[model samples]
Target: MFSRTFARSLTHTRPSASLSRACLFYTTEAAPATPQLLVRIKADVKDAMRSRDKERLAVVKGILSDLTYLEKSPQAPAQVTDSVIQILVQKSIKRRQESVQSFQSAGRADQAAQELKEIEMLKVYLPQAMTEQEIEDEVRRVVKEQGATGPKDLGKVMKELGSLDPAKAPKKTVSELVKKVLGSL
Candidate 1:
């Protein structure tokens, strides 16, 4: 009897219910996972499918295909960052814009309109664009910073503007703004 009591006393006591519960809650339930851009794209793709939205579904599928190609390409980077994905999305939009212009010039209004719709659909993945006045102000700032003298320095000014926030201002918009500023100067 004495040996049994001694053996029981030598063992460690169980953790309190409150302590165990707190630890479990803190470790397992404290921080919820935030979805990455890819996860969000996949979710939107599923939603588009469910809603039977062919336009949106086609755009999302195109984006997924681009991303998948990046993953499979031998020269692809170790990881695809959100910024890279955004750049790809911007390129896709630019391509559609070009096609829209081409179709319009060819007097194909219906095809041009369809391309514009696709551009609009893809733009949901891009960051919000800046206003015309805002873009001009930013371009002026860049021109002054580069000490651009005249039209000859246009390339230098353009190079500086290209380094601006790509999300807020696209390269084409920035170029147009720079041209207007230089024309005045």
Candidate 2:
């Protein structure tokens, strides 16, 4: 039933039909797993395993485990959308950041470095992060659109900005930019 274009789009360079299908289905729905992202992650994981790169392998395994857990959970409902995966990846990144900080504080530089590497790998799948200037511009636009003025209107502005899609504009960056813009108001 799948068209040739769809099938072509699905195939990862690694030759895994199941994974290709998963990638295509998610990307077509505009939710999360783009073919490029799936191919990259899968290839990296395979390379890590082949090269006996324990740290990288562990990171990939952790991500896959999380995906599996989400898949089996009743809370996921009938469809495990790309939006869900994106949220999971965000959470994973946040967790790694926290771990890196903790490891540094505990004088575990090796562990911290590993966590940082994993964070970098996970970030590859994420949409391009907005630069500070871009974020500031977006915040200003949203603030103006909402007619927000002064610090008292911070809540209103934040609510509006937070409603934006993280895939298009990350919420954390947008929040910081909004604060900066509102602070100067």
Candidate 3:
């Protein structure tokens, strides 16, 4: 009896055009809203695959994987930007640098060389690093702007510098420069 009723209901019902349209609207896949730089990187990944460049492919895939994981997290930004990519690249380079150091200490020159190559590949994506003179100039400007008169005000100047330029200025270099500039005051 239940099967008979189910068959009868199926035969009686017809999906209306409006209902079909609504379903299509809901079911159709939306275009990926990836940033331009990310799109370029993805294209590069394809090229790397075609060329069978294992090292480049691995680095690019790792970046995309990190992006995917970050997007899945609750705290991720609404839209991934190039700046986010830069930050991720910087972190990767830092990790590889540490690995290179450990490998060198262990006398594993081969592994250390591999890490160094990866670091160089990753560095290509980051913006041009600020020269020492440029960083020093920026530090001086921030120090003067904030009226940071001594080492006591180091935190304030550093905080301002971070906002002024986050990715370009190396933190250690900036701190040392800030100290030298502030100490003179």
Candidate 4:
């Protein structure tokens, strides 16, 4: 569900498939050449602007501004890709979550609600996060594969986990699994 113009722009702007693919996994429904997540974000931003959904529009605008700034930054290596965008979105979500907690702690319910709304909006672009069970299963598989037996093997396990495909399994979930497995060890 990507527009031709957007797809063309992406092709022209993005570095290479290998780099981007390393950052994100393409779903079966995604276009071969373009990341579906970016396309969806752009489309939703447009819709929000057109519908005059002020909060959504503002959030999307902020996201876009961040994306644009990142894309244009010379300091960012040439390998920076859509996967980098995914990382940025995750960071934004984390920031929003922290803000929500801080606001609630300060008795600023309105501010907390606003941050929560932004978090919800930002999550729309992230891949479906993996469940704890799924992450645990994968962690077990990795542990088995690496022959990791104790907490001392945590470094090896974490290295493997970091390289594992987050598109196939969410990173945060996998990280938690690593911690749990290590604790048990």
lDDT tens digits by residue: candidate 3, 1-185:
57998999989998988998887767566865777778888998999999999999999999898888888999898778887877778888999999999999999999999999999888878888889999998888787788887999988998888764446776888889988988988
lDDT of 2 by residue, 1-185 (tens): 99998898877447679987877756434564344544566787899999999877887777778878987887864665555566678899999999999999999999999889889878766776667787788789988998888778888988877756676577777777777788888
- Which one wins by lDDT: 2 or 4? 4
Poorly placed runs, candidate 2 (over 4 Å): 1-40, 50-52, 73-83, 151-163
**For residues 1-185, what per-residue lDDT tens digits would candidate 4 score against the true structure?**
99999999988885779998776875667444555666777898899988999999888777778877887888764554566667778888888999999999999999998899889888877766667787788789999899998888878998988866555466767766787897787
* Error at 53, model 2, angstroms: 3.6
Candidate 1: deviation at residue 150, Å? 2.4
TM-score of each: 0.59, 0.61, 0.75, 0.68
lDDT for model 1 comes to 0.82
Question: Candidate 4: where are CA atoms >4 Å away?
Answer: 1-34, 72-82, 167-173
Q: What is the C-alpha lDDT of each candidate?
A: 0.82, 0.78, 0.86, 0.79
Q: Evaluated with TM-score, which candidate comes out highest?
A: 3
Ranking 3 against 4 by TM-score, winner: 3
Q: How would you order the candidates by TM-score, starting with the best?
A: 3, 4, 2, 1
Worst 10 residues of 3 by lDDT: 161-170
Model 2 earns a TM-score of 0.61
